[model samples]
Target: MGNEANARQLDHHPMHGVLKMSEFINALQVGEHHQQQTIQAYTEYRFAYRICASQLRPVALLQITYVLEAISSATRPTIILQNRPDVASLFTIDPQTGVVRTVESNLEPGSTHELLVIASDQGLPQPLESTAFLSVTVEKSNELRPQFDIVWLTDNGTPQIYENLTIGYVLARISVRDAKYDSELSMSGCESICMKQTDSSNVYLLIVCGVFDRELKNSYNLLFLLSSDDKVILEHPVHLEILDVNDNPPRFEHSLIRVTFNRSADQFDVPRIVATDADHEGNARIRYSILDTNVFSIEPDTGILRLQKEFDCSAGEVRFRVVAEDGGKPPLMSIVDVIADVIESNAWPPVFTKPLYEVSVKEDAEPGTCLLKYLVSAGLHWINLYPFDPYLDN
Candidate 1:
């Protein structure tokens, strides 16, 4: 019993050479004579396993071997790869050392590899076999920098961003190459009103974050920076022009204009109908005209009004419309009412006054508001007073 216990304990030690039947018996005695003892054991097993590799790169990942109990006369397992026909060409395994390595370095990113590995122990009629699944996942690596393919919306030979576009409106699209890796995008000029959005793995959008006004800012010089793994790889410059929109109509300082002139005056200077448009380019160009062209005419470009012919004084007060139109796709316009009072020179007989009288008034003034008061000499010693009402024609 003692010899059998010692033999079993020795079986736990690593086996180096061949074992004989006589080695198991240290001593066996019966009736003062020595006797022989024999012991028998069997070898069976399981496996060890997994590996990881990077895409497009060669790697010798790990080794695989069968896990066996310490026993005498046990043979080392032979390892072999049993994989599908499609992936059989991609991997290789060493039969003696059980080392696993890649056959080719052309693995795609995000691809997973599953290999069935078999290990057979050398035994009598049929060898003991054990199987293990070696899972190898090709992880994507950040090796290449981000590349950009930009598409611009253009108008009249210029990249366009229409004024007053809503927030989140896409202005341009960019196709990115090698976008699976970690990447960052940044914009320099016009960052406050514009931003970048990732639409897909290889697509990106340039969108508006705020309103745009062509009158305030007509053009933008945008610098796009693309980075990979925190390193800047590309610096691209883009020129964007803000297209004009007819959002602002031609505006007149005063909606009503009043003029008093002497009946005997043949050719008198008429006040210019000043109008302004808060737009860009052709949208801001103003054209002026008088509806009553028989009495007055206006310059198309300068907005200067002038008397073209004589009018009847019996009407007392003559009213006309002055139109201001802008040059845009769909033109915008404004009209102001003009009143001319024909004062009979024979009755008033006023004289001696400055060539021009200028005055300032608030934009929000009420109608019939008295603006300017002037004193005029009726005769050598007599004086007359007149009030200038800016809203007289309202």
Candidate 2:
């Protein structure tokens, strides 16, 4: 009994390496011309499998022998995978061959899976078995596509400024999540905006890198790229919307305007000057006026010039300045020259300033040689004088 006390528990065997086994015992007697003693024999097992490559992509399969170590039993053993019925649903095992395989392709990246593997032998009365724990991990694939956030803003955000945004404006901040690789990102096919990353993070900043102009271009589209060895690993598309700013002043089509005036009418079209503004909304609204309104005025909405007072027939030419301004925060303005051309009418006869005049000419007083002439004309009439031998008036 002393020597038998050191014996191990009895083990059973199951045919085909089934995971359940029956118990059995073998006993040897120790004697010195004395009674017989029973010695018990036990079975032991060793599994040599430690999975080295279980990181697999989606829809991948792994062999069972690669992870299931061999089982040993004194009476020929059988091996099987043992797990809860529900847990068993995750995989299938060949009870005869001791092979295991996955049942689904829904593995997640960077996640681990575990299974219970058991081995048994065919023995009488009951069965003896040994168990092992196995683990596997799924990895991400290199063929996965990149993704980005979506935006649908027809109108620009608050402070929708299309021109001249401050140099350090914070346009956007984007955060990324990827477990396959720690790749750096770059921007391509962009003219106005740029991107930069902070130290030790996947977050980046979309910044205003260059100047903006609403007239030339108000928006941009950028391609965000991730790569290694100059080869593209992933790409995402982003769009930007620019709002119009009130920076450019209104301008007239012509810098100089000419107006013809008649004493009868005090109205004139300074060619109805045409002006344009580049800013958006109210900033692009333009107003017009004659700088000096004493003699001339212009319609604020329409650039029509008008003479405020009546002019006489002898009115002379005059020079006036016309101004155009836009309604911006700081307001912008321009000016042009408006010339008033006066055309006199022939409605009255000429009047002499002095009625009487004395002639201070050299009077020879000779017959037919005396001369006294005045530059005077009859009303709508003309005559040619005749001279005789002694002169008509001698």
Candidate 3:
């Protein structure tokens, strides 16, 4: 028979003639009989054939076909959503009308938003069917609003300070205001910026955020400690103090100048020394002095020195010490040194002299009197003798 013909004939047969004679007869006789003997016999045979045929088919084969069909019809698409500063909500759907929803607000900028969707058995017509994903994209909002404002004043008006001036120094007073809301702002970390000032001038603005103080109730005051680079040095808590006008002049911390002078130092040369005070300008003009005697006098207008007596370089070393005082009541004083070296100058010529010496001779003296004489010379006293020792030793 042709293949197509054989397949069609097998479909009508119970087991393609593979059923055992005893079993086939048992199956045929087990079914109900009809009032008409011919019809009842035919019905029983048809039932028995169907029962045998069903046993021949593998149950796993039917399940595999169903699964294959399900996979072929499954639709899976990954969902990606754009990050948003103000994302209202998200929704997901499956083929069987399954739904998932999520909501988010006040999302941070430059951040990603992610959501996962799991299909529940109730959402699917057939629980065993494999499901596909659905991807949806939501655009982000581009609107931005200002959140806060800040204002501050440095304790010394200037942001720069010397290393010595930085110790125990209060850099500045910072005040932050939340224009959006009325509340007290909580400081994140230590609020002080404390470091050496780099340039002659530096300015730092305190940073304040709405997140710090949700309610716009209280204004925040912080001490921003700053280094020379405007970087936060250290933060300290400072009680708000409305400063009063100046009442003091700048002053140096110490007095009793002990300066070393080399013989080479010129007479009446001025040296620069500085003093500091918390007071501002006009109130800080300092005047210096040489309290001892006319030996040294400071230029009243300029701090330059004027020597009354010429310094003696031959006197080994000389000291030109002076005291500085600011123009304040019971004036503040500081002592500073003007070191000078008594270096000898080669510009002066050396002096030479003849040396005479007498030596006793034996009784049998020679006819000519022994005349003994030597030359003595002196160079600049400052010239080191060791360097000329080789020539002198010869």
Better of 1 and 3 by TM-score: 1
User: Which residue segments of model 1 deviate by more than 4 Å?
Assistant: 1-146, 153-158, 164-168, 178-180, 191-202, 228-231, 260-270, 292-294, 312-317, 341-394
In candidate 3, stretches whose alpha carbon ends up further than 4 angstroms from where it belongs are: 1-141, 144-146, 151-185, 189-287, 299-306, 310-321, 326-332, 335-394
TM-score of 3: 0.25
Query: 1-394 in candidate 3: lDDT tens per residue?
Result: 1110000011112121221111110011112221111111110011111222222221000000011112221322222223233432422222221222233323333333333222222112222222222222222333231122223345455322222222344444333321122222233322333323232223223322212211221122333222224332222232222222234444444553333433334555444445654443333557666654545567754566555677666655445656656665555555665544434454345443534345565766554543343343444343222222232234
Q: How do all models score by TM-score? A: 0.44, 0.44, 0.25
lDDT of 1 by residue, 43-87 (tens): 212111112232222222223323333322334557788888999
Better of 2 and 3 by TM-score: 2
Task: State which candidate has the highest lDDT.
Answer: 1
Taken over the whole model, the C-alpha lDDT of each candidate is 0.59, 0.51, 0.32
Clashing pairs counted in every model: 0, 20, 35
| Cα lDDT of model 2 by residue, 1-394, tens digit | 1211111111110011112222323222222321222223333222111122232211111111211122222234355766666556555654533435455555455555566655554443345455445454444433334333322322344223456776666677666555235576777655666677767467777677778887786544455666656675555443345676778899877888777765434334244666888777789898987774467677899887666776654657778888889988888999988777766433344443359756543456555553444443333333333324444355
